[model samples]
Target: MVSMFRAASVAFFCVLSFAAAIAQPVKPSATTQGFHSRARLIGGGQQGEHWLAGVEITLDQGFKTYWRTPGDSGLPPRFDWSGSENVASTEIRWPAPKRHEDAAGVAYVYGKQAVIPILVKPKDPAKPVRLALALEYGVCKDICIPANADLSLDLNGADSERNAIEAALVKVPLPQALAAPADLSILSVAPLAGDKPAFTVTIRAPVGTKPALFPEGPENWFFSASHPVDGDHFILTVEEKPKDASGPVSLRLTLVAGDKAIETEVSLDASDLPR
Candidate 1:
């Protein structure tokens, strides 16, 4: 009888501990300080079977960081998660960034603070996930400086920062089909015939809303920032191309206007001239 009672007590305590873990929120990782910035790992615990996580970076006054494709200059943030434990895969979701112009040229960047949301899938949902990040990025103002941060957090429960993570996610550009929205979208893309290859991208945004276009392509291809031809028309000239590059290049374009933004992929063929 005593043996059965002891077994029941052990089982009850195990259940209680597991329930507590699910109910409580995990603490954020220690802040890692670098040049003009500080970073840390935050979590939203488990949503469904996957975990919600983030790399929160705070920048000093007048310092900014680059996006996935930094454009003319500056290095994008590189994340290394080899030090993590029980993690199957991780995806970093980037929020919409603003266009920054410096002597170097046009670049996409985030100002003040950047909370990059991460979607983490664990090897086992029932077990704890230890997330570790070795982050390397650049901070620029008068001068650009490379920065590094080693951040980590153990995700075993929900966190208060989940609301923050959700807010950041709201800023991420929604992927849309070409010409999807009637109010704001890519109206047309026309190939420009010239000694130097170029293309014209026409965008439509609500009246009085100035729109900005960001174009990204293969690493070998370099494109000039969109130049406004008129209210809704912009031209992007090809600055450089690979020695053996061909036409019909696939371009990833991000369109931003005020608080609204959308990302879409478009293909431009050198032969597809205006009708």
Candidate 2:
């Protein structure tokens, strides 16, 4: 379902723990059919072929978590991977998130446990691999609490467990393939003259559907509470914080209908209007 929640303001507060004793080795925490995370490594058959590492987070029942862009009031999860070797880089691939509303505000989160897939590339093919991750996420009930964990996995060589994890990861939703045909366009973004800096985003989509709009970054500067003028357009008000003036801004729009979701990225100017 298309959710009315905006993705910019979700609160995902993370506290860092670098002390060796504090930073435990990364491993899959025992599964309890509740909110949890898991990781595995895949690939290494052919020389020069990169290996992909996948991490899955399953949210427990009745509990909701924030999206990369957690709407107005929730904290989005923070991922930190420092002090590791032999790994080239890591990229986070988010599945299509569901929209949720609470007394605090609207948020986009996974209602059930979600498999968040990560791509890991190694520097050398012949050596054994050790992957480490320090992940912190905010779990919300009536009150929200920040959670942290340091997870590790060893990819000595290609194995069945790795292959199964990779296979399952692919089934998770990815941003819509660009090649697929769809009718959605970002029409315009313009500034709203007000005490707080605000902007209106004009979008065009199928006549009767609500499209999910998420601001990419500059987190605290924008509010997710949007005013929809009609089926095809909406106006979003952004706060003009001192820090927002320092960088270029962009917004990601996720439009969903039935089981299909399409994402479009739009660049915004310093004024919060379309560039």
Candidate 3:
């Protein structure tokens, strides 16, 4: 009887401890799910037919979010506002990305904060516009967690916060003439044997400026690291198309040269490619 009693006591404590652990809530990491963000209009000139707005995301220290193109791996944010009023289109612009590696692998990130500048155009420019946005994005620290928020705003006047949005907009890359002094252009594109056709692309920029190349396309397509050659040149290995890719694929390019940059795009027919 004594031995049996002792055994029951031990078992009871073990079960109790297990229950306590299982009932404990998960500790929130540097970035947690259902992250916070708000939609606001930054009224200023040069907005033209569209108004400038943003979904401002701020996470705790040590956390990070991804650029429009998250590079090798990471979740790029998505915005769906079809349910909005007087809404015609929403263009989310991205600033330059910071390159780094974590346990998850190499990723391009916007650390701790991301104010995704949105160009909102009204279906009828004469009518007042209201925006309702559904945003889905990823945040990372020790582990990656997907976050979401729904935001809405009415276009009105500029806020004191307008400066921050303007600053972020300034970081948006501008298009340049292929031969422009600050521009970087693709010199050649060659294919490599793969289940999903890949390519080796070469780019040239101004002399003496260290440059990095980022290739963006469908989610399945992946880009490799930049390899340097002699004379303001570099080579990039990229998955030019996604798996079983059928139609034409558009590949966007961003070149980071010192503190300046440029953007361009290339179209390749996936169904038919010779050499």
Q: In model 1, which runs have C-alpha deviations exceeding 4 angstroms?
A: 1-29, 270-275
Clashes of each: 0, 14, 0
Q: Tell me, what's the RMSD of every candidate?
A: 16.4, 6.3, 11.8
Which candidate has the highest lDDT of all?
Answer: 1
- Tens digit per residue, CA lDDT, model 3, 43-152: 33227788777767777788788788766555677777875788788888888777767554567888876676778888888887777765666667765555555566
Report the lDDT tens digits of candidate 1 across residue range 1-275. Answer: 32343355446545644554465343335577767898888888678777999988899999999899877776689898998999999999998888988666788898899999999999987788999887877788976666667678888896879999999999888888877766778877777788777777888888887788888888667676565568787887777666666567788888888778888898876344322
Q: With candidate 2 superimposed using the best TM-score fit, by how many Å does residue 175's alpha carbon deviate from the native?
A: 7.8
TM-score of each: 0.85, 0.69, 0.70
In model 3, pairs of residues that clash are: none
Error of model 3, residue 79, in angstroms: 0.7
Poorly placed runs, candidate 2 (over 4 Å): 1-48, 83-85, 156-181, 192-196, 206-209, 225-229, 243-249, 252-254, 271-275
Q: Give all candidates' CA lDDT scores.
A: 0.79, 0.56, 0.64
